[model samples]
Target: MNWKDIPGLDGVESPGLLIDADAVQQNIDRMIEIVGGPDHVDRLFPHVKTHKIPEITRMQVDAGITKFKAATLSEAQMAATAGAREVLIAHQLVGPKVDRLATLIDDFPNTQFAVLVDDPHAADAINQKCGDAENPLDAYIDIDCGMHRTGILLGNPSDALRAHLDSLSGLRYAGLHVYDGHLHDPDLQVRTEKVKEILGKVARHEQQHPSPRVIVGGSPTFGIWAAETSWHCSPGTTLLWDFGYGNAHPDLPMTVAAALISRVISKPGEGKICIDLGHKSISAEMPLEKRFQFPDLPDAQPIGQSEEHLVLQTPNAASLHVGDIVIAIPRHICPTVALHSHATVVRGGRVTGERWRVTARDR
Candidate 1:
């Protein structure tokens, strides 16, 4: 059996997520390697939003990755519970989440928790929530490089926000969190140049503000930031590589560790077959055809998908019978992992019957 193929896949349930433990370990090694080595492991602050499994967090912790970046409060809490020394909730907190952040800080005294603040309103809110605590919450200024998704703009806006944060009673200015997720050009040279440009702007801002630390880049620019010794690199998708990233970023040698198990449910027509896999199981953010890939039926065309059914048009569909198992590699693994409560663990090309819960899957 191929390394990607599960040995006892027939025994496993359909429309389930499968995690290759060996491949995960290999990817972890590759991540540490990209960031230099064991000596430079402290520079690796991996994002926990990808896997969302506390077991994987523990694996990273055991491998000497003490720091983590999370997109949600639950992810941050899961990382803290998994023995992370430091966990940063990378998203800006709002609503009653401010109180939750305070509670998380109080709940995990051993772990240092930080969050991103792009405005004074957010800073003051955090201050009001946890200002009087014995240890105030550490805050990082989220700089919007070009994504414009979050973070303050590079120049006056960021400077003003920094000064405002200094005046806040609760949130302390720790550093800058620059995520250039927008610089995902297929060409490494193009991406590198873009990263350099973003860093140049950040350098000028840091010169004025004197930030103590900095965390930069996601999976696309991971290698570039890894070369920069001063900045911390947070790449989440490297843990469980997906077809979307792997195909676009061939320079990254990370393996696709996660896959989906589905079975033929019906033969609707001569050239069409329906599978148990559907939008509810895998991440459907991409186009219908690009959502998942069938290694067994490489030429399979994903014609339609419903809540619990995916119809495929493939000449090879005639060869497959009802109840026959098929494996699919998700193009987007993060949200796909969240759709499932647990992932069936595979080791050495065999199903281990052990399942790892997606601990922080829910917001």
Candidate 2:
């Protein structure tokens, strides 16, 4: 989109992260609407790892989000400080991270903290630590429904592992947590079918040994899980959607909340101009076309990128000159948000004086 079209970024410097508060609120409301509103918002454990800012967490909490899932100790700390009723560190913490988490549990007594455990050895170590400190820890077996990454397989062997973990001291066995990020089909029905397949496995597991909760979904299939089942849904990218999710799933009613404000720095050749933004400004994880897209400059195509320069080849290149600002929406908002240290907050289509720290960026 054009710089003029985006609110609160009239005079902002180039290569900056601009966040629309109104758009974020709309995304949150959309999630709530999908998950059955306030009474069931707790079932939506929206991951805070997407936006590490405590202010955003507060906005979510004020909007009736009671549970959160974070991938780092820093994000979990922010969630706990935001007065979340429960926070799950969905990643395994090792070395210093473990100690920091222990401190977090002690410091934030009001927030019940949990961690994902796939290895019995790590569970033993954590159990030893928490048992020594006399502070019991809540643990969930990260079940691997399909993704071969961390987590025990969802069958017989897992039952034995769950029983072993429950027997361990200072480690309370909660339900299961699965991140089905691989289920990203353009067709909503295909996504829903995959969710149902996973849900069936989850149902059988719950029946054999009922845990207090089971958190599933990872942005793509959150709504599917919500529709077919009552389990907790964990969708982070919906908060600050990008072209990747929005373009793939048009049915999900979410707005683009995060955008990169950049300026043209040079006009080197015919039909070509370079922007201040590059791989450093946005996420490089996606494919070339999906990295970042300029909605307003539809003819402007990202030809190449480096650390600090995004070369654009467009027919309208001659219409632009040096110092012309443009807005770019990331194809993947989560990692793109991590690339910045601060976010420029805009409210009601007006720029606010406040700048929010991507508090957990370093962590």
Best candidate according to lDDT: 1
**Tens digits of per-residue lDDT for model 1, 182-237:** 88899999998999998888887778777878999999899988885468999999
TM-score of 1: 0.97
The CA lDDT at 173 in model 1 is: 82
Local distance difference test, candidate 2? 0.84
Q: What lDDT is reached at residue 2 by model 2?
A: 41
lDDT of 2 by residue, 1-363 (tens): 244575556678879998888888888898998989888787889999888888888888889998999998888888888879999999977677777777887899899999899888788877866643355678988888887777889877678778878788788888788889788999988888888888888898789788888889888887888888888999998888888888898978888888888989999899999999988888898777768778778878888999999999999899898998877888888888888889988887777877888988767
Per-model TM-score versus the true fold: 0.97, 0.96
* Candidate 1 residue pairs that clash: none
